[model samples]
Target: MNEQEKLLNARDRFIDSMAKNMSLYGITHSVGRLYGLLYFNEKPMTLDEMKDELGMSKTSMSTAVRQLQELNMVEKVWKKGERKDLYQAADDWYDSFTALFTTSWRTGISLNMSTINRSLKELHNLRDNPETPDEVRASVKLDIEKYQYALDYYDWLNRFVDSLESKEIFNYIPKKE
Candidate 1:
């Protein structure tokens, strides 16, 4: 009914909307709360303030901050003569989205590389063991080759992605006309 009450209501609505959106993207509730606070705050927030406002533990706040940092959605800031670290969202929203999507590809490449390495090791062991049936050995070899090809393809795709800027790629695509 009052001005302060209206402001509080708006803030709550903003926080709820942000939490829902971030949850859709697989972010935890604490992380979403932190983002909501940062999104509305005029200044960067300290961990203590975030913990008190979000009702989260210090460890939860720290972990959420670290995860947001890894996504490049949040960055650390320091003021002159300040002992504590402050955090804020990255400057560009589109760049933040790009960083988030890019992480999936990077993670995929690492996982695929590990799988390929393990398959190679298994193939080597099979070669050394005379008891492996010829048919089974052939099947495993085919699988290994398929994985290797997939790895190579992903490697090439990653290189291509790294080589071009997103803006450039967007401009180069022809219109539906």
Candidate 2:
């Protein structure tokens, strides 16, 4: 009903929205909340500040911070004369995307390649076996064609992800007015 209440409600809603969105991508609520807090405040915040604001234990907050840092979603910054580390959302938007592409995209492709590689081996064996029927051999040939297409796709994607330089991505992104 009051201005303060309205402000708090809006802030909480924003934090919840951020946390929910990040959770969809397997990130923790604590990291999401911290990112929301930093983005909304537009300043670095210390662990104690984030801990008090998010109502999380120090250890939880610390762990979340470390994960976020590893994911390039946040970075620790130093303030003059400050002994403690402060964190802010990554200034470069591409950092997070690059991190995700390099880790998640590459990893997923690698996993798929592993399965496909094994399947190809088995298919080869089936095609080569003298006991294989003509009809089955025809099907295996078709499957091999499809698998080769998929393998080529993955190879292209791996090279694409590798070619992506954060700087280049940032350059192509249109700047807001």
Q: Pick the candidate with the highest lDDT.
A: 2
lDDT of 2 by residue, 1-177 (tens): 999899878998988897887776677676788877877766788989999988989999999989888888888898899898999888765667577547777778999999999999999999999999999999999999999999999998887776564455445665455
What would the TM-score be for candidate 2 when compared with the true structure?
0.81
lDDT at residue 43 of model 1 (Cα atoms): 85
Query: What lDDT does candidate 2 reach at residue 72?
Result: 87
- Please list all clashing residue pairs in model 1, or write none if there are none: none
Model 1 per-residue lDDT tens digits across residues 18-78? 7777776667766877877887778887888888988999898989989888877888998
lDDT score, candidate 1, position 122: 85
Stretches of model 2 off by over 4 angstroms after superposition: 3-8, 169-177
TM-score of 1: 0.64
Clashes of each: 0, 0
Task: List TM-score per model, in order.
Answer: 0.64, 0.81
